[model samples]
Target: MRSSTRFERDAFGPVEIAADRYWGAQTQRALGVFDIGEERFPSCLIHAFGLQKMAAARANLRCGALDPVLAEPVVAAASELRDGRFDAHFPLTIWQTGSGTQTNMNANEVIANRANEMLGQPLGSKFPVHPNDHVNASQSSNDSFPTVMHLVTVLELEERLKPSLVLLQESLRERANAFANVLKIARTHLMDAVPMTMGQAFDTFARQVAHGFDRIDATMPRLLSLPQGGTAAGTGLNAPPGFDVFFCEEIRALTGRNFSPNPSKFEGMAAHDALVEVSGALNVIATSLIKMANDLRWLGSGPRCGLGELKIPDDGLTSSIMPGKRNPTIAEVLAQACMQVVGNHATITMANASGNFELNVAKPVLIANLLQSIRVLADASRVFAQRLVQDVEVNGAQLARNVENALLLVTALNPILGYDKVAQITAAALEQGVTPRAAALSLGLLDEATYDRVVDARTLAGRPGHRPEGFSERS
Candidate 1:
């Protein structure tokens, strides 16, 4: 190990740390032991880690628990971490300790070393600001990790995810209003059932997205409840009096988000139902996006053969094997992204359940999956809004052709000709590949003049100013 340069000793004995890195002995121990997947918690959490520690330092300083000489360097080091200057030091995998203690100490050690260095001390010197004793005072891994989870999730939801959903909803709403007069065949069981305005179809999808947004809004209060005051099995032992309240206040100032302590620290520590609730709400959104994406892909399936209600926006990609062929690339990728989020919710559910009596040990997996879900959902919403949903074109000519030829249009004649007569005309129309108008004429079910006036698709779709076949309403 390069002649054991820059050794630091912990309870585990002397271990070598990377010479240029800021993390110390405990973090080095974790790096040696856990060699799981390369996927790490994102750098945003590192920034959150910095904000959390800095809040603790400020809280302790205000309460006179920390000496000003020792606290200033810690505050400065934490600001660097929060500002994203020290993300490289937090390279541990997401599959580390169950309570995220390794990641916690990872943050702790880096801050301690950086703080000491600011005082003209060497890298390994823990004199002025010891990692756990000074940097982590009034906190524990159990409380601190979960608190950062809340901070990162709530901030991202407010700043990124909610606004993206609004953009998507507005895009869909615009299309609905624009297509208000365009009539199309509505399908059930993949077969035409009735006539309806295309606006109705797009409006239904917009409502689904709006409903998902409302569901998430309802869960925000529960998600914002922080477990930071719990401090190791919800007991808050070895912490200064009134530290929890002060910590929450400092964090509120730092983030501009009021994250209050959970009413029951034992409940917060023993189960992660709040984060699971957030994931569940996101899962429902994933389901909504998946449905809309699949609908878009199918509607835009073919320029020549399929439903052809829509034309997908050109994404500048082509099939390497087929010439001049474009795909619904954004919608397809959106489906895949939503599927990953649904699967992540499953992982979170299991982790949420695996926690025991006083403390849940599956915090790292929960944190990893929750953050991943947020990123995927936010990214997919933006792409769907800008590239696909906003840009997709309605095939007006195709919709007109399909409505004119639809065998199901025979249903509109049911009241005049009765159900049996209309069914016969529908079967004949389907078998001969002819318009229902032609079948009605051949079967003597209606005259040419009556067929022309009665089969107006816009009238059958209940559009305003519709008058059917000049027959009196009382008759």
Candidate 2:
């Protein structure tokens, strides 16, 4: 029988690798040593490594640091890797070296071995395509991994998260238009405060999401700046001069993004402040989502006993033991997702502070948390828009009843009558369990004609024709 494993040698010694696997000795060594976590790098990050390796090879070839013969197969293999042809070849966890050096070498070994195989050589042969000498030419994990970090971040944000946010914002705008005339009682500090249209509340949510879009836009310029040619210690080391420009140019050409090299490579590798800024923005978004979600859950609390202002969508899956109970399942899910993002931002902030003098040793955890936040937030935003926000119905009868019974409707009387008088009326209404209009008349605070004219909920909700900027009411 054929042997199941074959021997591959690196600087340390020879190690046995699976016969069909493409990764070489260093990756196998990492597998043996850092077997702590099951959290392997995601496919997007692995694909980013593929693009980085490909861009590096092209840059090295342009800078005369690599031979054309070797560049050919390296580029081909790297393109395949970028397209996810060899996803299984990468098996290292995020618990490895802080610089992600082992994962970088994993990419190099897989690309180099694949390139060698394409040239009719065995997998372990460090022949024409050496993993370090050629495949990783003019690059170091310190610089390259951070470059990959920025690339994946920008791609995920622009391609996934931002679009989902836009969808949610538009969905909220639609809801605002749909409920623009439906006046409801507003609460502040968990007490009845005043009257507001449901449209105004949803419009506020839309504006919050719009601000989230602006925050993400503010981070783009810094995130697009890469530090590829910094190499091991931000010294450029063995990398050729002008390699940074060439690498970014090749990356732009390959990915069609306007990526440029950072003026200070040391800052890029040593401080992940840009990523921290992104996490801060994500944290703000998480807080906003939590506010909206909690408000929704409160408004949609119950059909019989709770606020009953909103009718949450029923997905045919009610509470396990309580039959026919419609819970705010989507809002709860979204709030939980936002909570995780908030926790992720805290982790990212702490990880970013772990940056030392020349290199941040917490890169793997940092990027992992960042990407996880982006992905989950994006998915949650989409689900919130499609599953919950779009299907929510207004409890018009309940809203009317609440608005009629609200003691805070006496707020509209404050401008006409004195504040103390309005407070007395409100207190009497609460004490007698009577409507504010009845309380005002019974307390002789105002005549019935004046109270009816002043305490109208619709007029008290604020001016009509109020909509978020750039939003038009749909017919």
Q: What is the C-alpha RMSD of each candidate to the true structure, in Å?
A: 5.4, 2.0
- As for candidate 2, its clashing pairs are none
Choose the strongest candidate by lDDT: 2
Worst 10 residues of 2 by lDDT: 466-475
lDDT (10s digit) by residue, model 2, range 338-435: 99999999899999999889999999999999999999999999999999999888999999998889888888887888899888998999999999
Estimate, for each residue in 196-236, the C-alpha lDDT of model 1 and write its tens digit.
Answer: 88777777777777777778878888877887767888988
Where in model 2 is the C-alpha error above 4 Å? 468-475
Q: What is the lDDT of candidate 2?
A: 0.91
Tell me each candidate's TM-score: 0.93, 0.97
Count of clashes, each model: 0, 0
